[model samples]
Target: MSPRRHRGMLLLVLCWVLLAACTAQPTTEIAGSRPVDTSARAMLGDLRTLDPCTLADTAALQRFGAVSNAGIVSLDYCLLHLKPDDRTLIQLAVGELTGPDSDRPGDPVVPQGALNIVQNAPVPGHCTRRVRFGDGVSLQVSADLLAGEPGAGLCGIADAGAEAVAGAVQQGRAGHRDFPPNSLALVDPCAVLDTAAVNQVPGLEEARPRPSVGGHQCSWGEQSADAPRVQLQHTAGEPPRILHGAAVEEPVDGRRTVLSVVGGDPQVPLCSAETGHIPFGTVAGQVEVAQLVVAVPGETGTDACAYARGLARLAWPNLPPANP
Candidate 1:
C-alpha cells in the first residue's frame, strides 16, 4: 500500500480500538479542556471562537430529506428544520466540553475521521451521536423523531450529521463567529469566578468550578439534591425582572441589576442576581446579561441573596465592558 493509504488505514483502526475501549468501560470524567486530534485542532482553530452554525451544513443535511437551517438556537448548537413531519428535527452541538451523560455502554460506535462517534442509547423519541474528539470534549448530533411515523432510523440520521461535521473539519470548512469586542459569548464563565469567590459562601469554600459543556456557564460544588452550590452564566437576553419574591434594584460595576430570592425547601433557598442589559452581538439584539446564583441546602447561616449579590459585584467587573 502507498504510505499515505497505509497511514489512513492505521488511523481508522485506531479509532475503532478507542471506541471499543469506551464501550467496554464508560468514562466518569468531569467535563473540561483536554487535548484532541492535532489535525482537527489545526483545521478548526480554537473551539471557543468557532461558530457552531458552520457545521450545520444545509446542503449536507438535505440528503436525508428537505431541510432548512433554523440558524443558531444557542451559543453552542444550531437547529435544522426537517420536513414531512413536525416531530422530526436535528440539532448540531459543537465545542461541547463533554459527551452526553446519557451515553451508555454497548452504544453503537462508528469511526469518523480520527474521532470515534458513539450513538447514544435511544430514548422514546430521540437519538444522539456524540463525536468525542478530546478527553471529554465532543460534538453531538441529535435527531428527534416520533415513533410509528418514521421514515428513517433516528440513529442513522444522527450518524449522517456527524459525518458532515467530520467532513467539514477535514475540508477546513468550519468557521469562526465574528463576535463583537465585548460580546458575552466570548467570555469563559469558569475564569471569572474563582475559588476565593466561592469560599465567600459558607459551606462551599472547597467547591470546585465545573464548567458547562459550552464553557459559557459554570457551577461550583457537587451536583446533588442537598449540596450547596453556586452557578454563574453569561448569556444574551432581555433585562432581568422580578420573577418571584420581592426584587431589589442594585448597582454592580455601575450596571443596573436585579436581585431576587425564590422559595425552595426550607433548608435550601434559591437566590439569583441578574444584571441589566449589556451589549452583546447584534444577532441577539445586542442585549447581554450575567447571572450569579446560589442554593444552600443546609443550615449554614448563609444568606443566599447576599452571597449571590456579593459574588456578582466581584465578577461583573471582570466581564468585557461595552465599547463607548
Candidate 2:
C-alpha cells in the first residue's frame, strides 16, 4: 500500500480503538483546578462575552493551542474551539442541566461548592469531560486529534482546560463580547426541517424562513405557487396549542391521535404543538407551538396534518425542549 493510504488506515483503526476505550472506563486520576463556588445558571448569564476563540488567558497557553470561537453564546450553550493544529483541536460547550443525575456516570467529581466536574468517555481523537455548574447547568469539553501523532495525552489536556474554563465562568471571567439583541435569534430557522419529511407534501416541497401573519415562520412550498404549502410558525401565548404535548404521528387524522386535529377553519387545515420545557434550545421561552398549516385549496386534511407532524418532528427537536 502507498504510504499515504497506510497512514490513513492506521489512523482510522486507532480512532476506533480509542473510542471503544472511552465507553465505560471511569478514572479517578483526573485533576481539578481551584475551587469555584457558583451556580451554573448565574454563570451562564455572566458569560456576557461568550467567545471561546478568545478566552481570558489565551496568552499563557501558547504551548498547546491558540483560541477560537464558532457560534453565538446563549442561555443554553457557549461553544468553544482550541486549535493546536488541523489534526488536533479542543471543543467546549457549556449547557444547561439536561436531566436527572443518572445521565452521566458516577465518576470522582472535585467539588468546588456547587461546581461538579467529571471526565467523560473518550471518542475517536477526542477526550470528553463534564463540568456541572452547580445543579442546573453543565460544561461539556472535548479534546480532538485527527491523527495519532497528536497522541493519547489529549484527555488530560481536555480535562484541565475544561476545569479552568468552568472556574473562569464561575468567577465572571470571560472574553469581551457584544451580546445579540433578541434572545431567540441565535439559531437558523431553516436548518431545522427534515428534508425528507417536507418533500413528502406535494407542492410544499421547498422550505425557507419567512415572516407570516403569526410572526417568523418557516415555509415549505412550490417556488412557483403560494398555496399548497406547509409552514411552521412560532407563537408565544397561553394554552390550547393545536399539537400541544402531542406525540409525533404520520398521516395525521382528525379523528384519533394525541390531539384531535383542531378543525376550526375549513380554509386553513392546522394542528398545534406546545413547547414544554425540559430543555428548550432557542425556543425556551415560547409557550405554544402552532402546528404546521397546509393551505393548499385541494389538499386533504390528512395530508395537511401529516405535513404538520412531519415538520413538527424536525422542528420540535431543535426547539428548547420542555421537561423530559
- Among the numbered candidates, top TM-score falls to 1
Quote each prediction's TM-score: 0.68, 0.40
For each predicted model, how many residue pairs clash, with residues at least 3 apart or on different chains?
0, 17
Model 1 per-residue lDDT tens digits across residues 9-60: 2221112111111332222333474443433344567655667667866676
**Cα lDDT for residue 309, candidate 1:** 81
Residue 78 local lDDT, model 1? 61
lDDT by residue (tens digit), candidate 2, 144-208: 56443646477766666666766676566654434333323233344555556766666545644
Show model 1 residue runs off by greater than 4 Å: 1-40, 62-73, 80-95, 99-105, 134-136, 143-157, 211-215, 237-250, 259-268, 276-278, 298-304
- As for candidate 1, its clashing pairs are none
lDDT of 2: 0.43
